[model samples]
Target chain A: MKAVGLVAEYNPLHNGHLYHLKMAKQITKADVTVAVMSGNFTQRAEPTILDKWQRTKEALSVGVDLVVELPMQYAVQPAHLFASGALSLLDSLQIDDFVFGAEHPDWDFNSLVQAENKFESTDFSKYNATYATAFNNQLIEHTGISLTEPNDILAFGYTKAKLKSKLSVNLHPVKRVGSAYHDEKIDDTSSISSASAIRKAVKNGSAGFESLVPEQTAVDLKELKDVNDWNDLYPLLRYQLIQAPLNYLAQTYQMSEGLEHRLKQAAQRASDFDAFMRLAKSKRYTYSRIQRVCLYALLQISDEQMQIKNKQLYLRILGFNHLGQEYLHQIKKTVKIPIITKVDQKSRDGQLQLDYRAGKLYEQLSGVEQDMRRRPIIV
Target chain B: MKAVGLVAEYNPLHNGHLYHLKMAKQITKADVTVAVMSGNFTQRAEPTILDKWQRTKEALSVGVDLVVELPMQYAVQPAHLFASGALSLLDSLQIDDFVFGAEHPDWDFNSLVQAENKFESTDFSKYNATYATAFNNQLIEHTGISLTEPNDILAFGYTKAKLKSKLSVNLHPVKRVGSAYHDEKIDDTSSISSASAIRKAVKNGSAGFESLVPEQTAVDLKELKDVNDWNDLYPLLRYQLIQAPLNYLAQTYQMSEGLEHRLKQAAQRASDFDAFMRLAKSKRYTYSRIQRVCLYALLQISDEQMQIKNKQLYLRILGFNHLGQEYLHQIKKTVKIPIITKVDQKSRDGQLQLDYRAGKLYEQLSGVEQDMRRRPIIV
Candidate 1:
């Protein structure tokens, strides 16, 4: 039985995600579908509105065969790393196809990936500009098309990852449905909405978001007491930056070039997350990059530890259907890495420590146990 | 102008403290009154109900001529360390006498201190019992008098500190009035109440605590939006323990043995400060000692850094009246250490960093700035 793989955050598992999940199976004609979903936090370093469990239940309820966690070290990173991490996990699962949504699905991402290779490595070394801006400048110069939309950039990242890793899985980019990626409000006429739009509606207590989500997602959304976001996490982040020693903070993953001092000073002055972002944001670091660094600092994920964990990947199953169990049985002999269903003492402390810590941090907001003795959802 | 010294947490200065201040000046015949008070956190490692500045104002309002902050390195510590640190600062101020309240003021505290000196050092090495318990066992064996009351313990600590340092100042133990140290509710019969009782009354929104405190303290208490304590700080503490590496946690001041693992495990399972303390508490570690270690972890105060800072004592003046200014001027030439009237950038980032961080943590609860360019309160 061939399996189709998808990479997603499923922040709330909206109708758009359901559509994407449905398309993956219909187009690929696979017997099973596997999803590598981010756990607790998004790539932007924002806590998901729903935890990985709630999101997993939503995925299982929507007929996704298998759901596995994208470890925090990879999840809360840049597009290139996130795409690569997700693709590598899918490659481990031995999936036949990988499906994703892109703003311009027909764009030749392969050529774009190849175009980026020809640029001088020195182009990314400018201290006063973001790496994204630097990369886009060279991309627009070479290909006359700069990938700016979230999914388009991710598409380029996915294609680059597939080529660099020589993964045998096929890549399919379907056109994104509903509103644009940045749209904050839901369109009245559409039955689907962006995750951010759904989150905004849920946060504002606005009506009409229920129509844009699956039945389980709508129930979970209604049950949410508070929306998990950076605002709720700012206190812990600020405390970490203010209290952690400069030398210790300097050891955080991706922390470089006296950014520790910058973050520390910003934390000292800013009382809230928005103000902190404004103070920490500069030409060299994107807002998301700074936020991801903040998360790294908060979780105390050191550069050495993250690097070690990045190489030692695992498939932490969050949920599975009967077909997923059968697919797992078929792949069990061939799958080289550990596939964890229940978080045991040894694995929770070792290979899955980063994700466990990240989940614990999220537990502060959700008040739900994130790991430890929690069994995977079986449907 | 001779000065009399007092050690206080103030937390929120009450009528009892005002009486103690009056007694210091009256009994010692000192022209100036000086106080060395805990800053944002108390000796029990709990955030004070009021920030240091507010408490300083209350001190100065009731004629505490001068108020200096007890640095965080010394403020949140065991009785011996807290006493020694406070006494060293008062000694630097060149005061003629030191006054404090005692549950048994007539008890032979000097002999108690001498008895403690006679104890075998190995008596404290028992891993199955707390240092205080072991010390008390030896004390009970030597003098047949076990210091169980909080004030009595502090009196013994002060006597030991004075004897050990050979401080020239006279030690006066005045009889403690009104409520007991452990009393949680305000007693109607007495106008004086324990800081704990006043805090409880304020927390419960029970009336009559206003009459037990000074006018300024009453106003500060009334204006308080929330009571700052361990319950409010548990999240940050839990986050630190859960996220920080065991090696880093082991470096926490007074975090010896395998307490790091115990704290980490407790933080993982316990949802609140009380529960965490219960889980962490054992015969080997007192609740107060565990709480102090938790504070050290939350503040990320390394034992090495704390040792260095403890030796580098500074007189950080929090508030002063005209007489206080005169007293400071009189002692300016004779004082060996820096007498800080304002928190400069150098001090905030260097000598005062621990207190600054503690203040920042307290600021999260109070929404009031603790340090950084803040001038001492002048009356």
Candidate 2:
């Protein structure tokens, strides 16, 4: 079977997402299309507008045959670790092809991958700047392209992770359509809008988002959590920060270079997440960077645990159609990791345990309870 | 120079509280009435309906000469520990007379105190029930009084702790008036209403509670936080339970004899706090018992920390009138512990640190901000 895999948040499964899904299937002439969807927390280090289960239903409503959760370990990080998680998840399923949206029309995937390798091998102490800053500089020096647009950078990370994983999957890039990556206003001149713009419109209770997203995404958005914005999580995050002092945060992943002290001080003074961001932000950390760190602190994800989950840890089926079910049955014997469908499966796998904990956390904060006994969405 | 001390939660400074204060002053003929108030968390092991400062203002407005916070180490516990903290706080100030409401109107206080000493000395191995049950059984044996009224048990604990502290403070009791301790309805015949009933009426937005609380409490209720029932705190508590395993909860101050396992299991299956309580409760563990355990789990108060804070820790002056200032000045040379009017007092005191952390936790859960730098209330 020729299976094509795609990595996505599908936060709301907009028209853009549906278009990418259809193109992936058509371009590869694949028998089955698999999507590794971001779970409650996404690659942006924030909760997905809609949770994994809701987005799974939307992905199935589209032409996709299967949806799997991108374990929170990988989904709630910067691009590199996130890509490694997605590639390992798809690679575990023996996917033969991979498709994604790219902003740059023409790019040298090999050169970008080489740049990533160099950046990792080189010692970071020589540069006073963050790893991202130094890596972007290397990209500029090698590819002569900024490569900073959301999908473009992700595509680079994806290519590098795939190379390292030694996967045989063929990479296909579809030119991104619609407003630019950072555009956050729905119906802003273009008929097709970015997921962010749609999310913003929905959060603001604007009617414009209805026309922007597909029928399934639109309906799901109404039934799912209002918006998993940082503001919605302020209370939990604030409490977490207050409980975990500098010494406690120092043990967490992504807390280094004296960031713990800054975070601890900010937590004491800041009234909310936004205020904490403002109080903590300096030249060294960006808003998104601090956000991701605070979230890691909130979940108490330690550095040692992050290393364990650097690659794909397990397969979790969110939803599967008939074709997807048959494909899973065929690959079950060869799949590299344990597959979990119920909450009771005690694998002792750190990633899976953390995923379960994250599910409970998300449920508490968002007031959306998903029964552990729930079966995968089948359509 | 005579000073009468009172231990109180004064959760909202209701009419009942005011009546007790007046009776205490008149009966003792005291020049100063010092109240050792429960801070953010009360003896019931729950957040106070109003933050300490607002309650302090109301307390000062209604004849309380001084308002000192009962360190949380003593407040969020069962009757014994709660009374230990309250008594220590009052004793440190050299209070001459102590006054409290007693349900057993005709019982001799000295006889009850002697019975308490006997209960402590007698071996408890014969009884299979909790220490409380055994003590109460012994008390009935000695005094022929079945003393289980909410205030009656606390009064016993308070008297016992006062005896141990050896403070020269004389004990006085005023008859409790109005509704029963557990009453949850307003206007149940008597003019004086229970604090619980008044809190319930205000929480339910019933307008009939005005006659039940003092004028200052009525006015301050509007400016204070909305009611902080367990439902408002479920997310934080659930997060704490999920993060800490049974072994971790075993280390907490209140967790004992496998209650941690029951709490952790219920936290997963139960939807809210009430559900968790129902799921975890049994003959051995009542609702209040489970509440204190969950509260200690939420605060992550360790057994070691509790042991370190078994007595007088610090005196945090929430507010004081002119007479209170004069009393403190007169006793300043002999005050037993550090007196604090600012949040930054560095008391190498674990109880003080816990009090500060509890304040922050209460602020986060109740959406009330008490600035660490704010001056103490004075009238």
Best-matching candidate per TM-score: 1
Backbone Cα, N, C clashes tallied per candidate = 0, 0
After TM-score superposition, what is the CA distance of residue B351 in candidate 2 from its true location, in Å? 6.2
Residue-level lDDT of model 2, residues A1-379, one tens digit each, is: 7899999988778888878888998899999999998888866677788777878988888778888888888888787777777888898988999999999747877677776555444466677666677777877776676666878878888888878877788888889998876788775566689888888888887787777777888887776546767887777777776764456578888888888877777777788777888889887666677888877877777887777766447888899999999888889899879887765545432447777777777887677655366668999
Off by over 4 Å in 1: A125-127, B124-127
Task: Give each model a TM-score.
Answer: 0.97, 0.92
Top candidate, metric lDDT: 1
Model 1 fnat? 0.87
What's the CA error at residue A78 for candidate 1, in Å? 1.1
The predictions' CA RMSDs to the true structure, in order, are: 1.7, 2.9
Question: What does candidate 1's lDDT look like per residue over A1-379, in tens digits?
Answer: 9999999999889888888988888899999999999999999999999999989999999999999999887888999999999999999999999999999999999999999778877544554688888788889999999889999989988999999989899999999999887799899999988888999999999999999999999999998888878989999999999989899999999999999999999999999999998999988888888988999999999999988999998999999999999999999999999988888779878999999999899998888889987999999
Per-residue CA lDDT of model 2 for B222-243, tens digit only, reads 5554788788788788787776
Specify the CAPRI tier of model 2: medium
